[model samples]
Target: MDRGHVDAPEGLLRIEDCLDADGNVVLPAGVTLISLIDRNIANVGDTVAYRYLDYSRSAQPAVFELTWTQLGERLRAIAAHVQRSAARGDRVAILAPQGLDYITGFFAAIKAGTIAVPLFAPELPGHAERLDTALGDSQPALVLTTAAAADSVRGFLAKLPSARQPRLLVIDDIPDSSGADFVETVVDVDDVSHLQYTSGSTRPPAGVEITHRAVGTNLIQMILSIDLLDRNTHGVSWLPLYHDMGLSMIGFPTVYGGHSTLLSPTAFIRRPQRWIRALSDASRDGHVITAAPNFAYEWTAARGVPDAGDDIDLSNVVMIIGSEPVSADAITTFSEAFAPHGLPPTAFKPSYGIAEATLFVATIAPTAQPTVIRLDREQLAQGIAQEAGEGADAVTQVSCGQVARSLWAVIADPATGGELPDGRIGEIWLHGNNVGRGYWGQPQESRRVFGAKLTHRRSEGSHAVGVPADGVWLRTGDLGFYRGGELYVAGRLADIVVLDGRTLYPHDIEQTAADSSSLVRRGYVAAFTVPANQMPGATTQDTTEQLVVIAERAAGTSRSDPATAIAAIRSAVFRRHGVEAADVRLLPAGGIPRTTSGKLARRACRAEYLSDALRLR
Candidate 1:
């Protein structure tokens, strides 16, 4: 095993510059995550490596701590058992609930030199099909789970054919003494580490092959970009362990030999205040680093901030808002709501990333406040980003900031693959060492998405490290543009609804519809297009796309005349976006389909609406 070193820019902090507790640089050149774990165990074995908030049996959360030595012992014990059943480079599926066991199982597979598939338990509602798809694609040789989740794991596996069923291994059932028999496996920098399946927002889930080099590089990139070089940096997260952003919490702490406190997603959803309390608690020791999607910030501001006590101090926090479309309104609302509790405006760091790049791609600087600009709505519909003066005809766009230090990004024409200059929206293409190897079993898709080359010549003024001569760009399907050295995301290419030769972003329409009626749930609307034949009355040769809005009615809200609410939604869409809604379907709360990471699944909702699968409120 080799320790990796990053050739950071002159003023930037290098990977070897990140010091341990005694102010010593222990990371070497070409280090893998496994070697980092060993380094931490040797240098800071007594320090707390992970702290999990367990709320399974009580209203108040109980904290569980794992020292570096303890964590290493558990990893070795679990890896020894995994090595007995699975060989190197084989897939091992982690089907445990979110907690310490999930972390143990995931890293243990990596330690055993197997590609781990981080996924949720089958008991998690509304994600059975997603889990099934990922499992079918990966076809793991072993399944890792906790004793409490063994029954659900078996039940889920029973639905699959016997040939596809994987051997089950209980992580907690293995004793710590088993580590004595553990044998270290040699792993290369480019060895496949894990398979991060896409969240299926735009399409079906595909296994993105993340390598050891990618993981190590991305961790360093995140550390440098966020400026979390202090030894006392603490991370607090409530994200699901399976998602790409959530999995980053594990490696981030290990790289710096810092401590991370994790909370389950259900715990935070049930009481958003828990996330706030966790951050406040973690801030007691040192600077706090946290992240969540835009929706969580809105939810916390609406539900958690009002009830927060006066002693809640968020002055030392740096929160990253990512994992979905960044919302300027959400950032403003959250900052204002928490400002009374000592949250600074600069704490709202909006980032942009994808699973194909091993999680991180671009983010605002650690100390900079999130940038928000209002663009002319009409011009934006035609693929322009002109700033709008004081008027209602403007759409607010948040800047995702520059690419990470070692990564390069450019906006390219989606159709021609030609590079687009500043202020022009196109598919975001990225090139870096952190780019994933490729899709697991789809060579054609791997080449199409992860092996793109710019059709036009390169442009100057990139802030990132120079790309290798053989580097190929990974084409991110999300649309964005560059302005004043900052990247501003527009929307997904597939989710755009074209009506009468006009391009309309679904998020813009969905926001208008949600605001049109108090009965509609915010962040719970899906705006997409239905074919002309699917609409009530249309000719087969119309060849025009009709806009459809599916909204979830807010809980405890009812309309005496539902038609009035529908009329308001239709009127608002036309007044704001200049488009008439062909159909507006309002359903009970939780009607809209969402991915596992809580992003709106517009394509899936469109399929349900077309098939009449949703029941009206």
Candidate 2:
């Protein structure tokens, strides 16, 4: 593949041309996020940028509000403090919980010319390992945390060797420096903005090196794709700040010069109604846009807001369900459950995104309801999405919409690295200005993951216009197909289980297992395959892979007999997918591990299971 530079369109801004003699970035009209923040502060200083609720305060929630001007001032002060210890291009890690402090620290790192590494706080359960992995990978010079978490962070750092420990700065302790003179660091569009660590659901986490240009362009693409420019868009979110989706939901609204109301994830998990209520309240001023993973919708649907009365109006809400498998059933159930309260079916927007692309990929248009396609299961397993007959064995898959106009998407054969036609299942490949530079530090891995090129020519299919002959493409390890001009995600290539010369998706098996019994926790089951040789009793002739199912028991359940639950799971798996599990293990609540973004960490769970670390009943 050719690696020569291709001439871009005329009038297109290049990062190299925007630098000054001192190597500092000379600010262009509107190139970087810093420019956008400055514009928002100057034009709409008084407009609320963020409103957060602190449920830890009292019986009723305590609210905190930050306007654009206040946020900018705080960011400047934090930036000054951060610059005292770290130089430009250094990495600064943020370990604070979800609150204003975390937000300030994040933007402050960017303002100081340091790549911000957003990480879950050490206080969160099961986060120590992930935080350790991130810290070692990013090698940040300084760590930022809230006062409440400072001690905990310090204690965690004490466990690490002195050479690897980083200086911690508590955001609450940073003094006000509005009157102090501080030179704002210049920012280039190509400057490394932040390192967004992938949620290691399938593999170990890697820091995705996102540039200012990518972030700015992605925010623009999202605004244009969702048509939020002309509307009065207010935001509400219950997602954790560490995750990209959560950050974008809050960060993008501010970039678009709109207000965002944030609720703690704990609050949402405790009472799913809090999320709906926040959206309902925010809609009074303007239209609300909120996003969450698929399970949250099912959780809210299971616990309906029966007492909300007629005050709950989701008519002006664009609810985004993403970050995991998009379930048509979940969308239908959530819409039907809240229809009495004025929630329209069109409000449901199914989206597909990853951390590598700076979050906002393909999302259904705001005007249309999510499109669901019914395909034969057998055909789908055979790498072909054929429409099922009226009474045939069909599975429903939701469309994630056409690729954003700013980005180019193609389905490619993973083994051959050749582009496949539409309706053929293959790996999803993405190319755009929004794609990140590459993973941090791991050059070999980075090139392998981000430097993909399609070698074969396609005679028929929807192709990206103006794609360079040798442009680099991002190989999204996901398997999907394009049908009806929209993208339908099948499953992760690594997660597909091959049994008896047939392919099976883990989501289907997990869904069946969850539906088998009420005692089983939804979204807490993991299905994976183990080599036959790794099983307790297997011979060399047993070349077939062994299927292992690990599920979490629901709370307050008296199902002490594992046999009953195991039998139920076996029966369900056999009945639904014509497959039998080689092993079934049921553990107590919170048994299965999950990423900070609430995705099942199947690879991690499998590792623990093989090591006999799981607390089996």
RMSD per prediction, one decimal? 4.6, 6.4
Against the hidden true structure, what lDDT does model 1 obtain? 0.85
Global CA lDDT of candidate 2, please? 0.82
* Among all candidates shown, the one with the greatest lDDT: 1
Q: Which sections of candidate 2 miss by over 4 Å?
A: 1-30, 304-310, 536-543
Best candidate (score: TM-score): 1
- What's the lDDT for residue 346 in model 2? 81
Per-candidate clashes come to: 8, 0
Model 1, residue 249: what's the lDDT?
86
Ten contiguous residues with the weakest lDDT in model 2 = 1-10
lDDT of each: 0.85, 0.82
TM-score of each: 0.94, 0.93
Give a tens-digit lDDT track for model 1, residues 14-94. 465543564333334557888877888887788888899988779899999999899999999999999999999999999
lDDT of 2 by residue, 95-210 (tens): 98898888889988999889999987888888678889999999889999988988899998889889989888989887767315446789888998899999999888999999
Supply candidate 1's per-residue lDDT for 442: 97
